[model samples]
Target: MTNRVYVVGVGLTKFEKPGRRADWDYPAMALESGTKALADAGIAYDKVEQAYAGYCYGDSCSGHRAVYGLGMTGIPVFNVNSNCSTGSSAMFLAAQAIRSGMADCTLAIGFEKMQPGSLGSTFDDREPPMQRHLLAMAELREIAFPPAPWMFGAAGLEHNEKYGSTPEHFVKIAAKNHRHSVHNPYAQFQDDYTEDQIKADKMVYAAAGLTRPMCSPTSDGSGAAILASERFVEDNDLAGQAIEIVGQSLVTDLPGTLDSASLITLVGADMSRTAAQRVYEQAQLGPEDIDVIELHDCFAPNELLTYEALGLAGEGEAHKLVDAGDTTYGGRWVVNPSGGLISKGHPLGATGLAQTAELTWQLRGLADKRQVAGAKVALAHNIGLGGSVVVTAYRPAER
Candidate 1:
């Protein structure tokens, strides 16, 4: 039988624009988050049996170098990259290590040192992993210079066309996230804006109804998590703080992921839906059971889309969920309490683990001013475009 895995500790560095921090390299970022996680776990680095490091833009074995600073006990060190889902992928492996009884303790860390501006492939000599979506983009719409906004924006517009929602719904989600960030010390942007401000901001893609404020900005940050088997938690007397990983699922691209006939599928919403469904099934919990959510709001549209994907709303009903005020404080679910990727900054590799950290805090009632009242269960959704989606569920460990 698989053992239950508990997150004993988690740490996150405040997300910031790229180049804002001098001397903040991936290795440095890793150490900061790693040490914090270890301290939170009340454990020593020597207790960690294996480590996984996740990042998108880095050389091979950067995981080795990044995590090596955490006191080289000669454990297995893995470098993991799964597009933007890198962070959660690392956490998945760590949880699996414990769940399978292979290791009692594991460390998962993710960090990104991104370049400024919209994301583009660093290599020109290779067939891009996301070229499938690019091909669909060319067929479906004029290729925008920064294709991310166009793809997501067009997807938002598609939802609007098919579901009778408006871009205003997406901007409202962004504004809500920005308002949430005002209480998040670790978020990149604390400057709150109204839905009108977000809609009227500098346009990123007109068709998608995305403006500067509606999109996640590139950022530099790090996040780390330490997971332990239930036995290990008991032995270490960490029951007071440990949070159980109730269930998690990682899903990759399936049919219609890059369909040219429908632009909405271009952002891989179907995979997110599938993954969330599986996690809910495994956890024996539905979206209704989740009191808080830390979703991959890489763009405002994605947030609205995820509300439906995660079953917080029915088909074509995400906007209605927004109108009902069910996604914020005093609602059915407090989504993105850490401000989410929209305002929290998207540091590719670090994004997922950061979500993990946020949910862990929420479940433990340690989210400070952004805390969701009586948050007993939480969920995290992180996705990458090349593409992968990981959905995780969490609850506080039993005493």
Candidate 2:
């Protein structure tokens, strides 16, 4: 547990808009990013002793096919699928392998080509007649929240009611993220949006306003990172070339134990906080020590809640932080400088890896226009269904 591991290099393909047909297959994207990561690390593919590939809906043997495309030198490749956190989980597994002396170098790759339309099917089974009926009822209720006229309900309504967050507040998130996306060449939606435009958008879900609910569009992309132990890094003279993995922590929700009455206390939020605290302890750092962050913004409200959960802001005070511009670049701490799942586009399995890639770039001082000034410590947070959570902390070599 005390062993140190570092991310030698990171690579990511551009996230595309929903419904846009991809020119490259999943494996092709994986190989492309993997090759780029290896080159970025100044290491040959043959030097990668092990590989971990994460993909939620790729065809079978996807990992082997991708690695074979790079170079047919047989290496142990394990495919992982853990919903949205697949990529971070894969990276964690790879780091563990290297730290345990099972491998000198490891490659973790994540890819996804999500289909257009709603993601309801991806959440759970829709086969059983009773289940489908229940889902339909739930969907109907979600569409009629706040007694219909108010245009809000459930989680979004509750969040607003408690924190005095208006639809305009949510629009601010969209505006800020879109602005950030202008600097991220790999982001799907680089076009900027004004608050007026965000306010005018049509609503999607009842409680969740249009400006917030439509955060994640379907995306097709891939990303990869290479990890090596500190011993391996020193032996290979990689002192000034790696982003150190200062800490990693994971937590899962207790099924059927979530507080159903209060919409704010999501099981995932608690799980994420627990993991973040553990990571901070392991890294010997506090929330103030984090210069940059990439968090799961599956929805705008999710990001707001994350601030409180991560202790970056007090309970029901996340809106104040956003209003103060503390979450933006050059602020107290930059959150989701890569445009997040909002404008960056969430490709499910690829999202966790994409977050890591952004952090790696920031820590290396290579984030270009979107870079957080003087960033030395970075954190990436990802959550999956049933409240699976992972938080990773990184420190630049200069630190």
Candidate 3:
């Protein structure tokens, strides 16, 4: 990085099932989270030299509408949409602004008010963005269930077949995250579903025996993070609480992404793997150095597969880690203490920033009930299926 970037403040609104809260527009969600983030940073909106707003399902300049509620500061407000990686991608831009000496302070905010149920393409009139991905899956298996669940579930099934992982292993991940959610105020589902309950819930993908608990719920929420340069943090006396973003990388689909030969690749494991490798390389740290993680657990299977992708576990050995209880507290790494997307709710645009907020708290020792003891190094992974993946490493800033 040309300059160091530090996250001085982060904020989130409670995630809720879409439409469950009436008149809860994205604008209001944006205002609430944005205000809280500014307050946490001890700065005003005018201090932000630029802003990036991320949302997947919105009209043009939705970013302007959202940030105007914070202030009509007339900073360069850019709208970003990169599927589910939208939030982190926005953060990527803000961090770059600071890294390149273009800005001292910047804001990246994300908000989503999604329709309930499985996700689908917004435009039926034109070619869907995921047409190629779906075609890849088509060559491997018949498309039978909801597009989102089937895609993720098929990837899990592939892992199962290749590695002898049982449905129990996948359900176990869901159980752990749901249990974690009981302590998260922002989680949409705090029900501590047992492994048995997760296994027995109505199966969404019959082949993989994936139940509803194994999938991320569509939600309405917003999150915001403020980034500043080292000089800005020092000048503002924010080092005590700031989290240094040691390394960050955003990667999209590689050339072989559509092969579908490995359903793992079909669902973005390679993108995640490549991105994480770059992040680890830049941070001069590896999986063993990471004290905590908040990976993209959009589906329980993805969480398991991601273990290998993120280098937290060896290939075909993720189930072993789950079996040994290595993904939670008192393990090698405490992954997703925020309940993750599995229980935390996934408001597409807001999910990445929500993950960032959780890790920030963990590093700052401010995560209350979900705190990872003495968390010093944290890694965050968020991937979107048209295939954008972002991996970030963070450590506490010292005065």
Candidate 4:
């Protein structure tokens, strides 16, 4: 029998802007979440055989500080920084360790404290000063057509022009996700926005209307999960309540690949598809079998494209699904029910793990009002800068 890996517990700090008098920093948030996860799983901290902590802005040795807060056990800990995908990457590593018998139980944590500034510089380092200037010029050229402020708008323009998608199509996405967010107590922007409200908001990117609510707000938060082998689960009596990690895959973008089609059909998506397919093969299931999904919606357009990449919809058909109300809560397949990054807020490293936490809740039927009825199998997709993407498939133990 194949050794299955199960997520026994998940924990997350409420997503919010840090108050001036907040007591916890990034590491503290991570520790608190990690402790909660252990408590939730009914496991002791000393039982964790290894640890993986993901963070972006929390200075050097951030993971150490968080682990130390739980008491300095001599377990091996590795810090990971893969931009937005950090959390999932950390989980991937933990799963591998458990599968390989390197460790029976592992803890994966993601945390970040938002710093005020443009994130472009941190995403790519290969750009020379002149190349940076040229990209700026290209951005200007893009703005001339769409009149939005951010480059994501330029991406939206390309997707719209290519796929015949509309601003209103994007607005519907915002509305659907916001409606979902209202059910997520941890979501930062839970109130719904009218399509008109989204359309009338000031332009952040000519193609991407500020009214669309493109980016997640900067914030400080953390999320954590405990992964264990099937042997550990059976021995520990965690069988019926576990969330199985059936598949995990990560892919990085090729260098100097600026083809518009490449961005629309990201390499990470292909990698994730392959990964999800492998998971299905292992789990004896398929895309049509999944009941819920938590995908990266760093921007609205990204979600539309991801629908195609994840095999939920065909290319150019994603917009149609949006128009037909197919991606909503009661739709055939529900995406981003946690409000996604759009309304849930993205704290860099924390997002990937946040997606996992949301999936866990959905699988456990504990998502409160956002829960998909009778959810059995679910998927979580996350992407990092330079086009790194990780896709994971999960199933509740009851199924």
Best by lDDT: 3
Top-TM-score candidate index: 3
Per-residue alpha-carbon lDDT of model 2 for 1-399, expressed as tens digits? 556789998888998765475566887788878888988888888888999998877777887887777777788999888777888988988988977778879999998878775454443644531242233334433434212122123445566877787656667777878888899999988888888887677665545565433466768888999998887788877778799888898777644325244544432577778889999999999999999999987767677778888889877788888899899976899898999888999887789989989999898889999989889999999977544778999996556
Return the TM-score for each candidate structure. 0.98, 0.90, 0.99, 0.90
Evaluate model 2: give its TM-score: 0.90
Tell me which residue pairs clash in candidate 4: 146-206, 147-206, 148-205, 148-206, 149-204, 149-205
lDDT tens digits by residue: candidate 4, 1-399: 446789998889888764432776876788778988998789998989999999877667888888777768899999998877889999999888998878899999988877643354444657632243235437434434221124444555556777898766777887788878998887878888787777776555554554547556676788999999988898889887799888777766543434434434332455555556666676677779888889888777777767877888876777888977887777888999999988998888789889999999888889898989999889888976454788888987766
lDDT values for all models = 0.90, 0.77, 0.93, 0.76
Q: Put down candidate 1 lDDT per residue, 251-285, tens digits, no spaces.
A: 99897666547776678888899999999998999
User: Which pairs of residues have clashing backbones in candidate 2?
Assistant: 153-207
Q: Candidate 2: how many backbone clashes?
A: 1
Candidate 1 vs candidate 3, TM-score winner = 3
